[model samples]
Target: MTTDLGMPTVASDPHGHLRGTEPFPVAAHRALADTQLRQNLGHATRTIRAKRAAVVGEVDDWEELRRAGECVKADVMARLPELLEQLEASVTARGGVVHWARDAEEANRIVVGLVRETGSDEVVKVKSMATQETGLNEALGAAGIAALETDLAELIVQLSDDKPSHFLVPAIHRNRSEIRDIFLREMPDVDPDLTDEPRRLAMAARAHLRRKFLSARVGISGVNFAVADTGTISVVESEGNGRMCLTLPDTLITVMGVEKVVPTWSDLEVFLQLLPRSSTGERMNPYTSSWSGVTPGDGPQTFHLVLLDNGRSNVLASPDGRQALHCIRCSACLNVCPVYERTGGHAYGSIYPGPIGAVLSPQLTGIDGPDDVNASLPYASSLCGACFDACPVRIDIPHLLVQQRAAAVEAHGRPTAQDLAMRAAAAAMASPGRFSLTERVVKLGRLLSRSGRIRSVPGPGAAAWFGARDMPEPPAETFREWWGRRERS
Candidate 1:
């Protein structure tokens, strides 16, 4: 009388906290110190940005498409619960088993149980963000199951024991030579003379994975778009690895975030158009796989769909932050994000990185205090608005950043030095006498000026500000004094 996976029935928090161990600034400081990382990120992002721009320029209706994507996502969020139920019914009707997981642990448990039931110790994986978000590979390993990543980039990351740095290209932080080194070091049976050429690297990875694919009995994936109308789940990928995983395995399991659903097949057209150019800068994905359950004598004989909430419902509750759920995983925001271009993904300390991660992570985890790492995520950006411009659904990431910042400040419970300084400034400016006195007192700082610029400041919060920047010297006379002198004249 054992429940799934030989474990007693138990429930865990659906929104189990997922955050980086270190605060963003601390991590970013270490990341910034790596010159090779900066070079790799700069080169890769600039190339992707150019390609995305050229193809996006080809479409006359790109803005309209963005609008449509936004509208459909909004509709999905508004009717999420109903749509999810409909989706579950549709998949079930089509001979698929649907499981609802409130949080990461539940999803992992469900998936592990399914794999164990199949009696397979090994499973092939298509690159899936949902699985990564839940730490599925680690969970599977802990259960004595091996999850083999078939995607070339993912394989590199797996072999290196490294976290993914970019959304589409998980190993974008590594150059060819570095990838070659990892393969030489970690990949078993790799050719002794393997070169860093892209083709050779891909071939080495392909040969390594082909044997696994042929023998793997179970496959796992993440859904890009789930069509509730037809109970169809779709995965859009550039590599054919996804196809191998989806069709070759006897048991196919797909895990998807609740926000990934679209109302109908027609809704996919807009996303199909938006995702490619914004992501890989292609007119269309090289491989698009869709299935609605088990097909007799074709594809997997068994199908399971895990619908994962994991804080998405909580995200939908916030008016300002809910739009984060509209993300299509295209990584357009990441490609255009200046902050991400420098520090790379690992610094953010979450699978979701860059502009979207900055706002989304804090909301997903809930900012509990000033010391929370998720709270540090909001300040990770420069607020230049490039991410919003590149977003397929126009998420207005800067606005979300501000909202999260305010939320963090309110949650801290104790005033920071900057807060105390602001309060002091507010009191000084509240009355004419105090303001005039403060302005005259500040003019005394001209003693610290060199060539009409204050290169350094000695104070608590002001030191970090002046460390890399110089402030313009105050005017010879305060504005109030100038006004008074003019009146006297």
Candidate 2:
């Protein structure tokens, strides 16, 4: 089965069943009720925001680089189908197999079949949003394959059976003490005396993952970028686990979003500079591993690249929303977004969250109806434009938000009460006589006011607005009336 976006029915709920079931406001309300969650999110976002600001300030040509990245991505999106074909050809020539999946179910079936062919019941993984977006781990698990996450933060999320809250720092909502508790409770082999100290935690996780790395014969990962010109794939990480997964396994399978491809190796220059600084706030990532196809007796002897569309092709079809494909998953927007800082990623109800998610998810899901989980996502933003400034590829997120809002409203099939009210206001303002009469009508709001504020409005669609706030008393005289009086004086 396929959605209107051509996403496999299986991939429709990429966030797992329960998480993506609710609208953004419902999820956000629950999240807001958790005071500890708010504190953790606030502190983590503030810290990352500061680090990003400091490092980004050090770059002399950051804006130029952002433009360059944007231009390269625009070119990539324009020729994505061609580049993907070129990439497939290049990979095939280099002894790697490429599989194209239209949606999550197909991707999972392909991967599960591949793993089954290898006769491996277990696989180690580096953090890959593509796989996360497809719910690969759960699929593999249902197929009786254990997918072990090797990235520390991902490992933490996996061990605790929790969803990732931030793109860069998946467990950003968890503090050191909280991590220690998770480790103690979940890791069977963890030291009974394990301390919450950073070094101790690192050592503990290392000890746990080391055995899996050595024993695992199959590894699954996500690509940071695919070079269509060279058939080369890259994975950048602060930790060396990605390198281990790329090299140690006998069979390596990389699931990459179709949008992750760049036309050439030269295009990497702009992104490499933009990503690390924007993501980890470092001058350079600690580890960047790149490989092309298979090499005998060196890395994985069997290599497979699964290019996943899910709803990427659907997103590409949009002229206004397509800019979302330029996202590098830097999480800079997430760190800077006031809404995300307060509510956290879980509230967005997708593997993706924050400002980029707000714009991207709605388009990806095709906004099935007013009740769609994704329908609420476009309204998840404050439209502050901070996300645009923080974006490495310069996606105008606020513009896209408005675009998705229109899409959602149109998908509703009729004018909402709010829409009718706005239309009425527009009509009233279109003529001077109507506008003056409307102004006089508004003046009657004084009768409903108490202590100079209208605390409650008694009408359909008015409660949602008035429940959260008090409207100020209308001015006694219209601007035009005041202007006329001044002229007379």
- TM-scores of all models? 0.94, 0.91
Misplaced by over 4 Å in model 1 are: 1-17, 444-456, 464-470, 475-477, 480-489
State the lDDT of candidate 1 residue by residue for 128-206, as single tens digits: 9999998899999999999999998899999999998878999999999999999999999999999999999999999
Model 1 scores a C-alpha lDDT of 0.90
Against the true structure, candidate 1 reaches a TM-score of 0.94
- The reply for model 2, stretches above 4 Å from the true place, is 1-19, 423-455, 468-470, 475-489
Q: What do the candidate models score in CA lDDT, each in turn?
A: 0.90, 0.89
| Angstrom error at residue 38, model 1 | 1.0
- Per-residue C-alpha lDDT of model 2 across residues 270-342, encoded as one tens digit per residue: 7899999999999999999999999888999999999988777778887767899999999999999988988
Q: Which ten residues in a row have the lowest lDDT in candidate 1?
A: 1-10
Error of 2 at 445 (Å): 4.8
Top candidate, metric TM-score: 1
